[model samples]
Target: MYYDIIVLGVVVSILFSELTRLSPAGLVVPGYFVLSLHSPMRAAYTLLIAFLALGAEKLLGRVMILYGRRSFAALILLSFLIDGAIQASGIWAGNPGMIGCLVAGILARELERQGIVRSLGALGVVTGVLSLLLLAMGHPVFGTQGVWR
Candidate 1:
């Protein structure tokens, strides 16, 4: 199931991005997110962590010049730091590992480019479509016995 979801998610994300010319939160992000579907709160927590990284980048951007690779590195570093901080705070114990290795950073990048509303809207739409496709594939995570099995 995990294998299927990740591969399919990448494929879906690429297709969506090509069609819309948007990142869809990066190619692998939707896959990571879809895996969290069984636990909605975990998904929300992941989003919170991503938003935190994005916010941190905004703050950091004000102090120094952050663009291109610098901006990307800062976002990834921040995501890891914030994820660690959250875990250390004992809030959730496990931090869901950043949705994907670069999910938060890439997502932050997109949000900055397109604004939160448009970026998230694109992400939500892509993920929702991916979820529906997974459902049709008979993935147990979606409570389906396997319509296409």
Candidate 2:
């Protein structure tokens, strides 16, 4: 079931991106997010970290050149550092782990390319649609109290 959802997510993301000329965060980001619908806080925390990383990148952009592979690598590294700091500080109970950080980094990079509002809007739409489908399928989307379950 999880595998099917992931496959559908990838397909939907690709179709949406091609049709709209916008990325829903990243190709696989929506899938990752749908998995975390049970714990929305986890998604929120990940977004917070991604925003922090974006701010750092903007600040760093002024001091040095950031583009292409360099910018991508820096974002990933910054995400990891931020995730670690958040975990060490116990700022948020949920740790999104490396994959979460990577997704956040990817999303942040897209946010930089496309604008925050648009990027986030697309993400929200895709996530919401996928979440609804998962819910309709009676999956454990927001917990075990789902209608079908």
Candidate 3:
């Protein structure tokens, strides 16, 4: 059931990309975001990490040659570093606070490729559609805490 979300999201993401030619904050991001929806705080934290990664990359780009795979790698590394720092801070000890940890990196990649506004807009639309589809399929997207039903 958990994997179903990813599979569905991938399918929807592919279709969305083909139709709009937008990355939707990376191909696999919506599902991971959807999974993190049970806790808005976790989702917000992940997004904050992604935004930080984007800013960090922008600053680093001035100092280094970052493009293609190099940029992707740098953003990912930054995301991991930020996530680790959040974990070590113990501010969110009750929860890992980095749900969809790698998602921030992936999202940051798209945010770097597309302008943040466009990328975020597409992500929101795709995620909303996916959530609705999940609810229609009896996934119980709301009022279940972390459970499917």
Candidate 4:
């Protein structure tokens, strides 16, 4: 069921980007978002981390040359560090999983390329559509129950 959701998300994201000429918060982000929908806090935490990473990137950009691969690497590293700090501080109660950092990095990159409002708007739209589809398909969108059994 998780795999199914991810595959579906990728397909939908690709189609959406083709139709709208914009990415839905990067290629794999929607899948992670949909998977974490059962735990809204986790999703929110991921977004927060992404925003933090974006802020860090913006701040660092003033002093350092961040472009192309350099920016990507910096964002990923910053997300990893932030996730590590959150975990170490026992801030979040549960293990939101590693997808958070990856998703944050992607989302931050998207946010940097496309304005925050647009990227987040697209992400929200994609996530909402995926959630509706999951619900319609009898999948649990807000609990531990899996689509299969």
| Candidate with the greatest TM-score versus the true structure | 3
Scored by lDDT, the top model is 3
**If scored against the real structure, what TM-score would every candidate get?**
0.85, 0.86, 0.91, 0.88
lDDT of 3 by residue, 24-97 (tens): 99878998888877778778888899999999999999999999999999999999998887778876666546
- Candidate 1 lDDT over 1-149, as tens digits, reads 66777888899989988898887877788887777776666668778877899899989999999998998899889988998888888887655555656777778878887789888988899889988887677665542332222
**Could you give candidate 4's per-residue lDDT for residues 1-149 as a string of tens digits?**
77889899988889889999888998789888888766777788888888999898889999999999999999999999888888999877885645544788989999999989989998888888888888899888777763424
**CA shift of 3, model 2, Å:** 3.3
Query: Weakest 10 consecutive residues, lDDT, candidate 2?
Result: 140-149
lDDT of 1 at 81: 91
Candidate 4, TM-score vs. the true structure? 0.88
Query: Candidate 1: deviation at residue 107, Å?
Result: 1.7
**Which pairs of residues clash in candidate 4, taking residues 3 or more apart in a chain or in different chains?**
none
Tell me the spans in candidate 4 whose CA falls farther than 4 Å from its real position.
91-98, 144-149
Listed per model in order, the count of residue pairs whose N, CA or C atoms clash below 3 Å is: 1, 0, 0, 0
What is the lDDT of every predicted structure here?
0.79, 0.79, 0.86, 0.85
